[model samples]
Target: MIKIYSITVTTILLAVVSLISCSSEETSEKKQENLSTSPATANYAITPVDLRYVKLTDDFWLPVVKRVQEETIPYAIKKCEEEGRLHNFLIASGEMEGSVKGKMPFDDTDVYKIIEGASMTLISAPNPELEKELDRIITIIGKGQEDDGYLTTWRTINPKKPPAPWVNVVEGKRWESLTASHELYNAGHLYEAAYAHYKATGKTNFLNIAYKNADLIVKTFGDNEGQIAAVPGHQIIETGLIKLYALSGKEEYLKMARYFLDNRGRSEHHKLNDSYLSAAYSQDHLPVIEQDEVLGHAVRAMYMYAAMTDIAVLMKDADYENAVDKLWQNMVEKKIYLTGGLGARHEGEAFGDNYEL
Candidate 1:
């Protein structure tokens, strides 16, 4: 699976935020006292600085940012439009006729990711032209969304037929093949990108799409009656939901995120029938707090750790924090590659036994 390196991005974001403001010793002591009395009220240990407050003025990073603005963003947009990714969105909206037109089940995410990157660029330097282009993409994305808020172009285009042959076609119903369907994964990316756009532009156009889909998710899954009792085959949805919660301060979003995290490794929650995607492969063999070492797909493991860190700080959960601390130590001291790439071995694209790299 392709990983987005979210942990690295989040860490860098937090570091910049720290540089913008430094708390006094007395303020830190007061916060510590509050944590002891009411941890939930305590602020996140590290916070991401709003992009508006950051200006990329350094020589090295400034040119790189400018290149992405002048070259990379337009290039990626042109390629996506030329390659029929934009066409697929229209097809899903019934504006055109055909099956999905991509090799990967989650190909639509390429568009969403482009929008996210461009939106971030707009944050550092306001560009009306790029903002308009993003609006146009978001309009097409709105067309692709189902009335009920479903947005995966492939599955939305044709439920009975998947873009890739390996996807088990189970009556073409949504969520049937959690391990390969990638419906939830696509939604996760949409939510993430949409949130970024909202933060950058302060426009609700993209965010409304995210809100509708999130509401559907909140209604569809939980411990409540009539809700599905399963976790994502992929891990990033948990963090995506948490990001929404952080943005909107909605309890339902936070609860849904917690539901996904709390259910992992529990027998009653979702599990894959395939041996290859078995619990261990997805980091579902043991509860998050019980696992001390990383042992799954490298990106997925890091994404999950990122969520655990979010929960640890946002919710002030000690067990989750302790677990993440131990896991971080193991990765740094034992399994990490000399090149600094995660995943010590190629098999299963996961970590190997200690020092195996």
Candidate 2:
């Protein structure tokens, strides 16, 4: 069974404060002085302390992280194998003779997330066995990639037949249905996992896959002639690209991420999808900088907001910062649940109108 770690808000806040404090003896004092002068006008962003530097020893949170590292991680990996998540990779790579085996177009992300979680676990607790297993899994995943670096296994196995009926694939080609295809979403998770793996083991095996796929994405989408003008139906890719940019110092990756955000809600660039994939469903109803209220799938909205915050801090854009602030206030005051839960409407797994309970 999957074990959920129910971390309290106070515990999380304290952990964060402790981590920030550990950054430097004067970090907390400097932050306070900055807040006292101009609470929102800090010229620099806080640099996150690496997990290697911060050890979790408190009775409250250490157990939770241990549970994740010990029980949950192993359980998730076993479930993924049993559910054919691993086999899908081999099948796509032609190492196994079978069709895609999953219920979701984005099922590839299950493996990616597992790798990412395991990598994080390794950071705090070094395990040679786990590192070896990750290397094995990364190898299988790499085999599934197309020569050009596309790595969506289900699509690679059989683009004509999407794993789910809801995915609308008219052409049976890559990027045919950006809204439901989840191609970019898969890449996003892969990038995230790859980066984590790289950090944990100081390895480039998975990181190279991420970079190749990212390069393909950068070449595929843009305002340039012959390039497709579109945004992801779901979010997360923006943040993934931003992470890549931070690692590689690649301005193109950063530009690609900003382009995706800038083009959202601009109907002139591309028509939004219908039904659950509609503009509002993915927080594409308005440009990132102009979106004041939080709307859309709760997960999507949060990821978009995170990427927007990255943009605000990295680019020092006041407008983006303002929109994020406004949206946070709206969510806290009117949309968020009393228990801090989100997504009031289950049908779309989305946030409700203001004051909805």
Candidate 3:
């Protein structure tokens, strides 16, 4: 059953990788001449074969994949509904009247991640029912957005009262407490799920929501006059923007992604004294290129590394590539556990210092 579950999840990831590669190929060909200069024009070293072309005929794997499609996806969605993940969206949308209905500030991502998983499943196994359900979920999610494209439901429901007590928001406005609030992290997952939904069904319902929020991000956070010049306390938004740039050929998305990575660990860009914004807690101890060790929240480190790698390949950046290489070497040589788990400390869900495991 575990093997089946792993394969099921692997197929979902394959869908994301394959679809992104497809966009990369198209974008690369059109801007072939600009490959030398355009950050969005370059391609990754490897591209996965599209799920549609690859048949899962192996007796063991095929059953697992089918089980995921037949059982897991539906079960997961039901759990999300039971957990109030869906209700939070309705509350933010004003379709329901209640406080945010989750314990975590980033509970919106539970719905987004499930949609992404379901959408990825749709790529290999087309299901009209699942697609329609996703559309309904997407509509609820869309209705949660503020007039200016902001869509963090907890904050939208009540900025002063975050869903999680640790979120540290005292009459917070948007982006006020970026580190603990997870405002951008919510946006990142939204973009990812939207892209997957668009890829699977070619529908604009979710994609449009992603685009509108991204446009607002581009306008809100920057080095320009009146814009907030700060990076996300958590990562992944960088890669999310890159995905959008791949689809829209929008330079702003690509640049914004680069901006987030470039400003990490730069104290002058934004003060980082919060408990969650520690120099290493979120991997903000050093600028991304200067980061040699893989210390921090494991998930955030991985996401940041992904964006770094994307920039390294896309922009042909030697510094970024070197840093990524060093971080990789450090992880494999000293940090990684025997079980292949990346994080060792459960307290922070972080990597331990050199063999601390």
Candidate 3 lDDT for residue 266: 93
Candidate with maximal lDDT: 2
- State the TM-score for model 3: 0.87
Global lDDT of model 3: 0.79
lDDT digits (tens) for residues 1-357 of candidate 3: 000010123546555544443323244444444433333433554443333343344455556657787898889889989999888888888889998787998889989998987876665566788888888888888888988999998888888888777777656888977888888999999998887788677889999999999999999998999999998988889889988987788989988999999998898998654655578889988888898899989999889987887778777788888888888889889998787778889988899989888
RMSD of each: 5.4, 6.2, 6.0
lDDT of 3 at 306: 78
For each candidate, what TM-score against the reference? 0.87, 0.87, 0.87
lDDT tens string, model 2, 1-357? Answer: 101111223335545845644333345556556343421223334433333344455666656767777788889989999999999989988999998887999999999999987886665567788889889989989998889998899888999999988888687988877888889999999988887788678899999999999999999999999999999988889889987886787889988988999999988897658434777888877888889899989988887887787777777778877888888889889998888898899888899999987
Among all windows of ten consecutive residues in candidate 2, which has the lowest summed lDDT?
1-10
- What TM-score does prediction 1 earn? 0.87
Off by over 4 Å in 2: 1-43, 58-67, 274-276
* Cα misplacement distance, residue 139 of candidate 2 (Å): 0.9
**lDDT by candidate, in order shown:** 0.77, 0.79, 0.79
Who wins the TM-score comparison?
1
